[model samples]
Target: MRVAVVQVGYGDAEPVPERVERVAALVRAQAGHDLVVLPELWAPGGFAYREWQDRAEPVDGPVGQAMSAAARDAGVVLHAGSIIERPGGGEVGPDGHGLWNTSLVYGPDGGLLAAYRKVHRFGFGAGEPKLLDAGEDVVVVDLPLRDGGSVRAGLSTCYDLRFPELYRRQVDAGATLFVVPAAWPAARVRHWTLLAHARAVEDQCVVVACNTAGTHAGTEMGGHSQVVSAAGEALAMAGADEQVLSVDVDLDAVAAWREQFPVLRDRRL
Candidate 1:
């Protein structure tokens, strides 16, 4: 499967509306790619905590609509990064906050394929934990390939990479491809790449990690967006700047690697 990982870079000076339009255009540019992935919270900004509340929208809000159209125009399965979701009807989380850091995927026909609310909130007591609800369910969706076949993709966000159990559960659910969107900071960028390789090696799944770039709200985003094979091979990796890493991934290799290694079957835990 051909994939395009768009590593987006934005700053505080750029308005959210212009950024949204820019990202949508970027998605539209990857016309022949089977899958196009974006970074986490690229719309509302990752460390722009103060802006999230004002930028929050529903599932089918402006960001979603723009992504849907972009996917349709590009004819690719688009992982349209993430958005700050404030659903209507006054729905609130256990913490009394109705906001959610939600990721969205769209089909070639501009249809909503899947939406995964980030389960592990990054901040311990402040940012996410204090302002957004933790997602309770794990999301796995079937992604279409160019060969008229499909691959089961497990969805997780930035901080979710630290927890192995979440991916273990996804592996149990028959996921072979792991889609991870991150806005990891430059300070711990090493951890970001290392953890991605670890997840792919351990789970024996294709890891498509899209991360953000540039400084925003005083935090520099780590921009090494990458794609790792089931065998932990870094097929493609971008730099610490805005880039689009396009590479072809063999989905069939997952099963072959699992059969060859058979490590997962020996797990006793």
Candidate 2:
């Protein structure tokens, strides 16, 4: 399968709608890709954590609408990164509060295939635990290709990379491709690259990590978007700049590796 990873540049200066439109145009320009992945919180900047309430939209809002259109126009399955969404009032938990950091997956038919909220919230600097609600479920969806094959894709965002158990669960659920959309910072560029490869090797799956470039609210991002194979090989990588990194992934190879090694069969839990 041909996958396009978009390394987006984030800045608080641009309007959210304009940014979404620009990225959608970029995705549309890259024709013939089976899947298009965007960075986390590509619509409203990730650093705008405090302003989430103001910028948050419903799942059927403009951002999701634009993504549906873009996916259909591009003829690719889109992992539309993530956005701050406000769940309907009374749809939330006991507290009655309603908002989530959600990722929406759209098929080539422009239909919603999966919706995943960020399971692990980043709580180091600004402390996300105090701001956003944590998600409870893991999302993995099968994306059908035109050639009569399908890729089992797993959904994750940003800080979720630090947790390997999630990826293991995805692999156990028959995921061959892991997609991580992040806004990782420049201060931890090394960790960003290392962890992605580690997950790919450990899970024996393809890892396509798309991180944002540029700065957002004084925090500069490490824009080394990369695609790693089941053997921990870097198929394609981008520097600290905005660019699209496309790589061909062989789903057959994943099965061959797992069948030869059979490491997953030894799991105790």
Candidate 3:
């Protein structure tokens, strides 16, 4: 399938509404691609901890509505990065609210395909852990292919990259492609690249990793959006900036590599 990885760049100067508008336009621009992916929390600013609550919105909020329309307009499956989700319910946290770092997906017809609440929060005791509820289930969805049929894809957010078992579970569930939307910082970009390839090699699936660019809350984002094949090859990569990368993902290669290597079957633990 043809994929577009949008490495968005922004700073504290950019307002949330304007950022949402810009991102929606970017998604709409990828009409020819089968799937379009964005980086995490571009609207609310991933590292801008203080602004999360004020900018937080429900699943059908402004950004979500705009993206759904863009997906329909473009006729492509869209992974609209992530949002600071203010989950609707009576369940309240210590701060008298509940939230989640939620990833949203829209199908070609502009319908909600999947919503993955980030399983792992970045901050240990503070930040996300203090405010947001952790997601329990692993998420995978079927996306259309270039020729016909669909490909099973696994979804995970930024910090979850450190955990191999998450990808392993998705592989066990028959996922052949993995989509990771991150707001990774510049300091650990090497780890970001390393872990992406590691997950692709270990799970024998195509890994699509899209990261943020520019700066947010004084922290510089690592902008190296990349697509790694099942054979651990970098099909395409983007530099540290706000740009979109288009690459064709070969689903058949997953089966071929797995059959030739058969590494997953040898799992002992």
Considering every candidate listed, which one attains the maximal TM-score?
1
Q: Please estimate how well model 2 matches the true structure, expressed as its whole-model Cα lDDT.
A: 0.87
* Clashing pairs for predicted structure model 1, backbone only: none
Please list the C-alpha lDDT of all candidates, in the order they appear.
0.95, 0.87, 0.91
Candidate 2 wrongly placed segments (more than 4 Å): 94-97
Each candidate: RMSD: 0.7, 1.5, 1.5
The worst-scoring run of ten residues by lDDT in candidate 3 lies at 88-97
CA lDDT of 112 in candidate 3? 95
lDDT of 3 at 184: 96
Identify the runs in model 3 with alpha carbons over 4 angstroms from their true place.
91-97
In model 3, how large is the Cα lDDT of residue 261? 97
Find the number of clashing residue pairs for candidate 1.
Answer: 0
Which whole-number lDDT from 0 to 100 does residue 89 have in model 3? 66
Please give each candidate's TM-score: 0.99, 0.95, 0.96
lDDT of 3 by residue, 1-269 (tens): 89999999999888788888888888888998999999989889889899887988889999889999999999999999999888666555444548889999999888999999899988888877876888878998998754678989999999999999999899988999999999999999999999999999989999999999998788999999999999899999889988889998878889999999999899998
Give me the displacement of residue 26 in model 3, in angstroms.
0.9
Clashing pairs in 2: none
